[model samples]
Every structure is written in structure tokens, then in C-alpha cells.
Target chain A: MSVVSDRVTALVPSQWWQRSHELLSRVFEDDRRLLALCLTPALALYVLVAILPMVWAFNLSLYEVSTLNPVWEWTGPGRLLDIVASGTFQAAFGRSLVFGFGSVAFQIVVGVSLALLVNREFKGAVLARALALLPYMVPAVAIGMVGQFMLNAQYGIINLVLIRVGILNNPVAFLGLPETAMATVMVVGSWKFAVFVTLLTLARLQSIPENFYEGATMCGANAYQKFRDVTLPRIKNVILIAALLRTLWMFNKFDIIYIMTRGGPGETTTTIPLHAYEVAFNQYRLGEAAGIAALMFVFLALWSIVYFRVARPEEEVRVA
Target chain B: MTDIQVDTLRKEFSSDGGEIVAVDDVSFTVEDGEFVCIVGPSGCGKTTLLRCIAGLEHPTSGEITLGGEAVTDVPPQNRNLAFVFQDITLYPHMKVWENIAYPLKLDGVGADTRYERAQEVADTIQIGELLDKYPGELSGGQQQRVAIGRSIIRSPRAYLLDEPMSDLDAKLKKEMRVELQRIQQQVGGTMVYVTHDQEEAMTLSDRMIVMDDGEIQQFGSPQRVYHEPNNVFVSQFIGSPEINLLPATCRDGATVAVDDTDWRVDTGVDADSVPESVTLGFRPRHTTVERTADPDGIGGEVALVEAVGDENILYIDSEVGELRAVADIEQNPIEEGDSVAIGVERAYLFDAETGETVATSRRHGDRSEDQVEA
Candidate 1:
């Protein structure tokens, strides 16, 4: 006991250990007194809200948890297999992957291009940047509302323009058609979130040293070559991080698409979140919804690992 | 080798309120294969002048000629002049190999040739093993070498180095000084170097251009400029511990009355051209001090004795206020609070009113005629 106390005391700074070193640390041996005191309130809330729910849902996946039916039937893990094999869940999973990745890809490309273009000084640059930020700053629900009006089949401005231009004899059903519903929602989502990537890329771009460009100029590089050699390499790291964040946000995105196309003209854009919602609320199959949510959690965890490993966005960037 | 000349070059910049003339009608010429240094205090337009010579800056109303062709209107790319900036501006992204090869790649060179030339330049700079490392991984000095390597990969008309050694430690700076001199000798171009360090200017330059207030005070060989300063500013600026100035008047054709002493003036000033009032300038090495009360010399008291490794500098208080003198530590030892007598052996006289040189001590050994009537 004496040896342990002496070692513990040695670990602390001498000045601090010199004063008030005994009573405060007697708790280290059976430190549960203070540990339990410090850990009670926050731990209670987390367990009740987070841990308990997740554990219950995992256990609930093995039984029939129904709201309308009174009888509880033990189905074991077969419930999860049933949810996975359902055609609607499969379509929702595939559609979520397409909407999440496809929109985020276009967002990255457009975002980085705009960031590079606006990084330079010119007349009205500040005003133009502020104007470009309006689309991203607007609420996503409002943007979806506006997108529905414009993408309407009959009298929408898009169809009106196409009709006026005489390119199409008939107005295309952008939201009602299964083929174009997912793509329309993707275009709208990318339009709304592209500013996030632009801001991130631009911040990193501005941090790059001006002397690098001057050195390139001295080496006889033109404006375009300077961008290719110096600017692109410096900002690509932040673009990787921005793309990852956007993809994660879009993967579980439900509200914007739900308001715009509502699982789209026969489930063309029913993402994982929407499917989980329909199962829990409409069908009242609580156990199947839990299973679907659990699967999504697994897939997201695997995705995050693979994406971070592949991107490795921690490229060396000089501070000065 | 290239013959570069600036015909009354000037540069101006507009600030918030008005135009600021950075280089005020500066003109000089760099001979082929000559190493010239432009040295001045900060904000004295030495770097601006070098930038103009590199065609990075456009002159306000002047012309620059390279190889007997007017290149004032030529862009820097067309001028074919290379510049090494003060800061080591290596690309932080590329490896040392690609950074050195980037310039050749921009000129549309093939990948194989670019790789070969980059490796050769990397070997010249002695960074072969570190070629695969990014600049962020290199030390400040290594990055500086990469910058120089990038500049020297191509044979530009002339190399303009802008205080490229200012960012090194003292010992490292000395080492890199030798490295730079060796590289310059090997490359053998008309290199125009800019530095505010007069010691560096003196050591590295074949011909030095001393500037102040956007004007050239003196342009000559380092030996000639150090021994015979053309004006009081040049005299005080070119040396450490500073030159001492004494107020004097030309009493007659062959003598000058300085303070309470009348001394024979043997400076090369012709008797007919000698001005009435002058300031006598002498270097610390020229001022000899004796630790005794000698009637023939001005009496002084030693205020401080500073030992500077190889020599000692004595700060003596006399009728001229504080005067600095140097002594060889091996021959004569000095101490504080010693009564001393001061005498100047070599003196440079300048016209007090015009601030121009009226006479210089005869060290050139070329001007044999003594216009001093004695």
C-alpha cells in the first residue's frame, strides 16, 4: 500500500504533490466513490436515452414488436433477414446509395471549381460570392418547395422554357417519372449543399502561401500552369474531407426528398431513412424498423472506415 | 556573360494618397561576367532595382538594355532572367525531384529529359537522397538550396539573387555564403545580388553599388570603395564601428584648422579646388590612441574597451565627443578608464556644405600628382 501511494505521488508534479496530496487521492485505490459521483447524472441520461434504446432495439429485432397486433411472437434473427429480403427495402438501399454518392460527387466538382474561380480578386467579387451563398443559406425545406414548383410537369418554368425553345413537344414528368425523380432530387440536393464544399475548399486555398505562385512565375509558369502545379495540390485535401462529410449527411437525408417527391412516383427515391420511417409508422412493425436501422448503422460504419482509409486526407500542408 | 545597362531607371508606386517614387532615377551598368551587389538600408530600393533588372517591374520612364538590345518593354518570361527570392519559396506539395523538374516541364520538355536534368541539378545542390521528400519535410536551409536549384536549372541571361542568405543562422549563413560563392564561380553569369548587409556586399561582390535614398552614392571595386569613399554617407555606411567625423576649416592652401589643432593637409585635393569648410573623416583603424598625455595629440579618456575576438575597439571621449578607435590585441592592449591621446593617420575630407568628397587619402597609387601645395 505504501509503495503504491509513493508511486502515485511520484507521478504528480512535485509542487502540486507537495500540498493536499493525501486525502484527495486516497480515492484512487477504491476510486468508485468520486468516480460514481462524477459519472451518475450524465451516465443515467445516456443509458436511458441512448444505450437502453440501442440495446432494446437489438434485442427487439429477434421478436415481433407490433403496435396494432397485441400478440408478441418470437421470430429470432429471421426478422432482420426478412427485412433485408424485402423488395422495398432493397430498392430503398440502392436508391440511397445513388442519391448520396451521385449528388455529392457533382457537389464536389462544382464546389471546387467555383472556389478556385472566386479565390482571385476582381470587380464585384464580394457581391458575387454573397449572391452565390444564397442558395445554400436558404432552408432546405423551402428550397424543396421551390424546386417542386419549378419541376412541375405541366406549367413548370423548366418545361415552359423547353416548350418555348421547341426542343420538346411534350412536357416531361420530372418528379412523377421514376427515372427522373431521383435525378431531380439529386440535382436539387447538390445545388443546396454545394456551397459547403466551396467554403471549405476556399479556406484552404486562401491559406496557401503567395510566394509559391511567385516562385512559379519566376520559373516561367503561366497563370493556368501555376494553378495546376500549386493551387490544386494544396486544396485537394480539404476537398476530400468536405466530400466525406456531405456524403454522410446525404446518405441519411430524408426530409428534403420526402417533401419534394415523397418516395417518388413509386419508390424511385425512397432512401434508407424513408424506408425505416414507413416501416415504423405506417406498417407499425417496430421490430423490422429496428432491424433496418441497425443494418444502416453497420453499413455506415463500414463505409466511414473504407472512405477515410482511401482518402487519407491528412496530406502535409505547411502552416506558414 | 551579358552586358546589362539601365538608362536612368525609375520606379514609382501609388499608395493611399499619392505616388511614392521607390527608385529615383537610378542608373548603372553591369559588365559581362561581373558580379555586382546593390546594397542599402531597408526600403532603399535595392530590391526594386533588381526586380526591374529582372523585368519583374516596369520602369516609370527609363530603359533597360541587355546585350545591346532594349528590353524595358519585354516581359520577364521573354527576358529570360531568373530570380531567387529572399524567402525559400519551394512548392510545399511536390517532392524535391518534381519541384526542381517543374520549370523544365513548363517549357514542354519530355518527362525523361526533365527527370535527367532535375537529378543533375539536385546532385549539384547535393540533395540527391532527399529528392523524394516534400518541402514541408525539409529544413529551412535545405529548402533554400532547393529554391536555388530550381533557379539554376536553366541558363537565364543573368541571375538576380535577392538577399537569398538572409534567412539562415549565423554559422549557417557563413557556410552558405561560401556555397553561394562557389556556385556563382561555377555558373559564371552576370549575377546581380542584393543585400542590406554591407559585409556580405564587400565579400561577395566584384563591383559594389552603394545606394541610399534611391540614388547611387558610389559604384566601384570593393577595395576602391572601402578605401576611398566618395562622400560622408558612403564613408560612415561601409564600415562597422562607423567612421569618425571632425569639423574642420581650410585655413590655407596646404593646412587645415581642425578643432584646436592645425594640421598639414596632404590629401589629393588641389589647392585651388579646396573648399573653405570641410569635415574630416577617418576610419577606426586609422585612429591611433596612446595611453599617455602627449602634448602633440588631442587628450582623451578611454570610456570603454570592447574585445572583438581578434581585435579591440576603444571608445575614447575627447573634444570631439565620443570617438571610436581600433587596436590590434596582439600588439597593444587597452583597458577602460585609461588616459589617452588620439591622433589620426589617414583622413578623408568632405565638403561640409555640399556633402561631397573634397579630398581622399592617396591609397589608389594611380594618382601620382599631389595638387596639395606644401
Candidate 2:
């Protein structure tokens, strides 16, 4: 290992390395130039990937274009207005709200609970924490498949167990029924992402000192009171930030829902992402699909700005 | 207000090496409204004992009682004790008033009433203007005052402070020590304070418990612990600048032969009655020094002259070891490398094997060791 490390070190030219170090130090000596040098790559990448694509989509939204026709016709903002006023678009937006809110709520509740549970000291606490994060590491395709198998009407363990325990007289076709399809897909879509919340909440929870609880105890606070006074305040900002990210991801979520229900038992789980996919691919009207995508981008950007302005989660870091 | 009685408390913590006894069969009492300071070196179980009394740490065996009620089984919250942690754990998110009135809020007090009470408590602790600011916005001393305000808000049965001012600078520590004493007097509550600083323990405590190795060496008033130390450890640990110890052995005619020197310590008692092997302890203040070339007296060269306030403490490098002797800075006019003769005006004779004080001199140049024994 020592010989290999020495050889690795020897691979770099000594004078060239010294020259580069000197050059870097000289460049970093100027604050404005250093700031520009540090930020340029990230800024360039963001513009290329995110900003350019969004601008292209917005420009595409102004024209009536189709893959089938190989022709573009200038239709202006009338096409965007028509897409927005359509019943299909309105229904998809409502479903997006339901799935987004439901998944975020479920994730926060389960994630914070899991974080609290695994934060304790026990015999196999390290193993338990690792196991709790295992779901998040699993691929989205595998999550959808496993979710489908578990919720199967015929041989699914869930229906069988519920029927065996006599809670249901019949095995319910969870995905086949429009009433349960959206709810089921929302849960499955949120399963892996909930661990993301757990990871953030746990990191924040661990940073809270043990003396805070002891101080609370000395202040005559009971178990519930301690949680409200000490634990909740410390973890509040992390939970809020997690919920914001989860809501954004859930709003634009497509893969797991597509894999499981494929826009539903008759459009039940068809969120904004699924609607845009169907409009772009199935209908082959690229302009309208781009219009829908552009609307989503604007909505999410506005929502993020509003959420940050209202919540002020940054105050926690300042106070801490 | 309640007196805390800890009876034969023993706390053992298991580590890879084995069981470590943190508090070893210790027992003491803090009378109602009295401030008792438990003083010790680090890891001496002083903090553990205070936590045990507050019911934060469960004892492996024995009991603690508050106002004649056993609280060993009770949780810390139910014990109604206010604890100021050594680290000064003020809630960072809460404003000063909210942190102060958290206990009242927990007790189902309304916001308006609790805020009013918090403001009053904050004012009493000299943090009235900081009520609207968060803990992170305050300095270390202000944060400590907020922590103290939180503890004193509800007037718990007793206050347990574990080196609350240890994190402050020397100037801030002195200021807070006086502020804490004033608050204790104003509240008139029983307090069990733990600190490693001997000066803090001496000045702030009604009675101080000097501990080492999970056991109390002596427990008494500061003056008593200073002048009448129960053992060598207490004598060395209690006094600032530390007490100097020299090895000596009993000789003929009520005298003890000092180490490798012709100097003799008159025990003021029968020489045969004194232990054959003994240790002599004398504080720097009790020790006297003179410029002399006499071979019969203890001789040393002053290595360092430390001028502290009105007195100059001379660190003498002698034949036996380094000895400390204090003198009036103006009168002594001492300098480094100056040869001086050292004398013990009042000294303590400790048993060499056990480190227990055998006898103590009663007065200046009046060595009546037998008088102390009687």
C-alpha cells in the first residue's frame, strides 16, 4: 500500500504541481475573481441543463408543432390558454394536488417517527438505522414492482391478511378501483422518498444536545412536554425543508405511478408529469406538451418562493 | 424549600475495562436554604453526586431524600429540582423570556401570565433587556444568566448547579459568582453547586465538600477546611497556591528531623509519642521566610516571585523540593535567585503512611500539637 501510494504520488510532475498550486493561490488572492472562478462552472451547468431546456419549452409552447406533421405553425398564447381550460388538464392538476399533499403528509409523519425511533441507543441501534434507510436505496422500478405485488387483488399478502383477519369480506382490486388507485400509488410513490425525510430529520435530531432534554427534565417537563419544548423546536426547520422538497418531487413524480397504474383506473393517479408525458408522446403535440411542462415549471418556482418567504426555515440555522 | 439528604449513594458505570465507581458510598446533607458546594478535581464524582441528588442519574444503590421524602425512585421532573448544567444549556431557539418561563409553560400556565413571570425572573437575574433576544444572540455570561433565570423562575425545591460559570473568563466568572450568591440569597433556596475551582468553592459556599477519587476527604466551612484540614489531600486541594509538604521523621526531645537538614520541628509534645515517619504541611501564607546563611534552618533560592495583589509568593527551590512562601510585597522586597531561610510558623504533622493529619500547630510559633489532640 505504501509503495503504491508512493508511486501514485510520483506520477504527478513535482514542478507542474508547484506551478499549479502557485497559480491557484495567486488567482484566489483576489476575492471577486475567486468568487467568479468558483461559481462559473456550476452556473454554466445550471444554465445549460435547467434554464436552456425551460426556455426552449416556453418557446415551443408559443407554436403549434407536432412530431407527426413535421411542421410548425405559430398559434401564440391561445393554445396554452386552451390547454389550461381543458377538463383533462384541470382533473390532472387536482389529482396532482391530492397526491402531492398526501405523500408529503405521509412522509413527514412516518419519517419523523422513524428518525425518533432509530435515534435512541439500543443493542442493535446501528443496524436498525441502516435497515431503516434501506428503502431509500432501492430503485424506483423495484419499488413499483414490489408495491404492485403486495397490493395484488388475487395473491397479494395485504388482501389475504386483511381478509384472513376478517376486516374485508372480499379481496379488493386496489389499483383497478379508481377510488383506491390514487391513494395506493401515492403511498408507493412516497415509500422510498420518505426515507429522504428520515435521513434529514435524523441528522438534525442528532445535532440536538442531550443536555437540552436534561434541562427540560430539570424544568419539570414531562415526556410529551419535553418533546414539544425541546425536540420539536430543534427538528422543526429540517422537517419543513424536507416537506418542501418532498412536495416538489411528489408533484413532478412520474415513474412509480406510471409503472404501477399508468395514469390509472381511468385517470385517477394522472398527475401533472403523467399528463405532460401523455400529451407529448401519445398525442404527439409537442407544443401543447411543452406548454404543460412550462406551466409546471412556473408553478413550482412560484410555490418554492412562496413557501420560503412564508416559512423562513433559514432562521433556525441563524439561531442555532 | 427543602433540605436534600443523600444516604449511602453508590453509582457504578460499566466500561470496557470494568465497572467504574463514580460515586462511592457517599452521603451528605444540604440544609434548607443553605448553599453547599461540592469541590473536587475532574472525574472525582462531584457532578455525578449532584446529578444523583437531582434524580437525573440513578444510583446503583442507596437513597436520596428531599424534605424527608425519598426521591430515589422519582424521576428528575417529579423531584422538582432546577439544574444549571456546566455547559449552560439555554434553549437556542427560544427567546430569553420563553426559556426562563418554560417551566411555567409546561405547568399549563397561559402565555400572558407566563410571559409576565418570565420578565420578572429575567429582571431579577439582570437579563431584563435580553428577554426578547435568543440565546445565540447573547454573550456567554448573558447565556449563563438566562440559564440561571430559567432555573430560578419556578423556585424549585433546590438548585443544582454543576460548574455553571466554569465556561466564563476570569473576570466574568468573578462577576457571576457574586451575582449567583446574591440570587441565592434573594431566592433563599437550598443549592448544591459543584465546581473544580477551589476559590469558587471557598467564596460561594456556606460549606464545601472536598472530594477525591469518589470519596469526600473533608466537609466543613471554608475557614475550617482551610485552617483545620482533615487530611493531607484536603489541605493540598483546598488552599490556593497549594500547601507545601515535606518529608520528616521524629527525633529526640519533642522534635522532628526535617528531610536531610539540621532543622528540627518542635512537635510541642513527647518525641516518643510522635510517629517515627511523618509529613509536614504548611500553606504559603503560614510559612515565614528570612534572608539568612544559617545552616540549621531550611535554606532555598527563590526561583520565582509571583506578585498577587498585596502579597508576593516566593517559589523557593530548596534541597528537599520546591516550597512556596508568601510575604507582603512591599515589606519582603524579594527577588529571584535570592537565598532565603524558610520557617513554618504554623504547620500540620500528617502520618506518612496514611496521609492523615496527626496534629496541627495552634498558633504562630506556639507549637502545641498535644493541645489539638486533646
Looking at model 2, residue B285 earns an lDDT score of 88
- DockQ-based class of model 1: acceptable
- Report the C-alpha lDDT of model 2 over B1-374, residue by residue, as the tens digit: 99999889899999999999999999888889999999999999999999998888999999899999999999899988999998877777778888899899888899999999998998898888988898888999999998898898888899999999888999999999999999999999999999999999999988889989999888888878888888899999988788988899875645678878767876564344457788888788887788766535776889999999989889988888888989888887788888888777787888899998887777645322221210
CA lDDT, every model vs. true structure = 0.83, 0.88
Over 4 Å off in model 2, which ranges?
A: A1-22, A317-320, B260-262, B269-273, B364-374
Query: Which residue pairs does candidate 1 place in steric collision?
Result: none
Model 1, residue A107: displacement in angstroms? 1.8
Clash count, one per candidate: 0, 0
In model 2, the fraction of reference contacts reproduced equals 0.75
- The residue-by-residue lDDT of candidate 1 on B1-374, one tens digit each, is 68899889999998888998889998888988889999889988998899888877888989999989899998776777778889888777678888888788889999788878888988887887888888888887888888888888887788889999898888878878888888888888888999999999999998899998888888887777777777888898898888988888876764566765644444444556768888878888876677785435554788998999978899888765888989878788878888876666677888999788788665435552222110
Report the C-alpha displacement of residue B56, candidate 1, in angstroms. 3.8
True contacts kept of each: 0.47, 0.75
Candidate 1: Cα lDDT at B1: 60
The pairs that clash in candidate 2 are none
Counting only residues 3 or more apart in sequence or on different chains, how many pairs clash (N, Cα, C under 3 Å) in candidate 1?
0
